[model samples]
Target: MAPYPPPQEAATSTLAERVGKGPDQNPNDTITTSPNCNPNGQESPTGKKTQASPTAIPEIQWYYGKHESRIAYWLLLSGAKHFGYYPRGTFNPFPITSALRRMENEILQCLSLAPGSRVLDLGCGEGHISRYIAREGSFPLVLGLDITASHLAKARRAISGDVLRGFLRQGQVEVRLGDYHDLFTSGTGIKMGEWDGVTAVETLAHAVDTKLAFSEVYRALKPGGRFCFNDYRIGIPDDVVRNESDGEVDEKELSPQQRKTLKAWRWVMRTGGMKGSEYSYAGTYERLLKEAGFVDVKVVDLSENMRPMARWFWILSLLPYAFAKLFRLEKAFYNSVSMYEQYVEWGGWAYCQWSATKPAT
Candidate 1:
């Protein structure tokens, strides 16, 4: 076999393989998972060689001092029933805030499956989504997979997170540490005609490679199984530059420089741990999904039904991550969160939620 890569090779790291890339998130909760580490091209549980770097290009986003981001987030939101920015930490605040409870209800509705369905929640933080599926009175088996040990750790310590109010609906819920990329490469994880459903919310943006990510999802599902989730594409607007075709600009269709800048945003995320990729106009997303092997792809503007609260939530959502390391506000972190929350409650912000699905056999 080929020699393994170096320590910086994220895909092969003891930590990275154990869970995919760590999720940089915190809204109302957390997500976690675990697994072995092997940097080789294949998933050799054997743990025998060196690691291989997943990419030739540097990543755009990374978990820059993420541990600090997590601490700042939880400390700031203590005792709050709902975050209004990021529900349970993995879902979105935009759709929820925009449509009141409708967005949440709609997503839950979209996820409603017949009994005995096998479901996978990628980037399942704190197991809330899986918990919901468990209580959902539908899926008999619900699995939430995430790449953050802290998230899995917190889920394991559900008693402490207090934030993970999972359906408490029985042992139907399981949180595991694994990467979607590896999950795709490992055919056993998905039986050819086995899965009934697979759902990912607000997570595709975090994948190291979106195109390959969809292909993995496609391989995991049975024909006709719905691969539904809200994800971001490549085009988003800056303060300037508007497209003539539509009221807004399509960054995907922009000039080369704009395209490079757009892609660079993702680069910053890989290195800095911030995400600006995955977010683009719905149409552009539709095109990419088809190119990725996802058929019958559709984009829904759940944001139309979104509330101002979600906008408010995402508007200041970056605070914890942005300031966590710079200020190392460890001592006054709680105070900072409190002030931010108060500001959001006083002001309002919202974001869009786009849901899609994979074609069944």
Candidate 2:
């Protein structure tokens, strides 16, 4: 509407540098850069606007790359690749790593998966969860799939020495470059109905198309297989509903500051590969799973249980926020920090444990 502001070349490049090169590093060559681009933001010889290009947004991708790189680096630093589950809170007397181990064990218990079952860890970063499943649950074959090569490399390194038995007898776990949205469509080299269980941890929210992703998961699982994961659920305040129509929520009704906050929040989620446009609400996952041919779909609210960890994140976000504001990279910084704060404070989002079963014939 405002002429879409000339490509912020300097800022864009800086942002890209901060994260890593996006899917494409050359910023000026974007679909929007063409002179013949039409009113609908599409390139055409006729110069007639039809619809926007379906290409990924470079800024968002760059932001996510950096965000993921940061996560990988942090995992490298922690030597554990996770912020260990702090169900009670970070200040508790129990050790963090032990809690993390316990959390994984608890999740596996819920899955009721037998040893030697094949588990696919969707959106698996560093294969921490997959490794845990393999080592603890004795799930001989575990596959971790992620879009980031670096993260997958980290996962591979982390699970390198594992020597359990099953589909992949040489290694207890494996890592692959795959995206949840294209698990079935793209050539993942994994067969349908091959997995006994699939686990996604704080990952499904990042799905660009929740329905498509769910459907793909459905197709990937064996009959009687279980899909389990935890992720954020939408939880909006009463005053926040400015506009709601056509399967979209308009935040124009929010205050100017609130609108800016929402913008920053989305940028952060986008960096994590989460699509706010396609994100599901509290009860939506159950319905979507049902549509995807899943049965016994259950979405459990674990918001209170996850708050302690959220509190820790809130406390940790301070320095980054200051650094961004200091360097005037506030917009890029907002992509993650404030969005997390909203989850921690305003009930903007709820963390939930989800499980669904593919029924046996």
Best of the candidates, lDDT: 2
lDDT of each: 0.46, 0.58
**Candidate 1 at residue 325, lDDT?**
41
lDDT of 1 by residue, 148-208 (tens): 5556656655623322343243334556655565563332133444566777765655554
lDDT of 2: 0.58
Per-residue lDDT tens digits for candidate 2, residues 122-201, read 87776767877766676656767766556666666555443322212344566666666555433345677878998888
Q: On a 0 to 1 TM-score scale, where does candidate 2 land against the true structure?
A: 0.71
Deviation of model 2 at 327, angstroms: 5.5
The true-versus-predicted C-alpha distance at residue 59 of model 2, in Å, is: 5.6
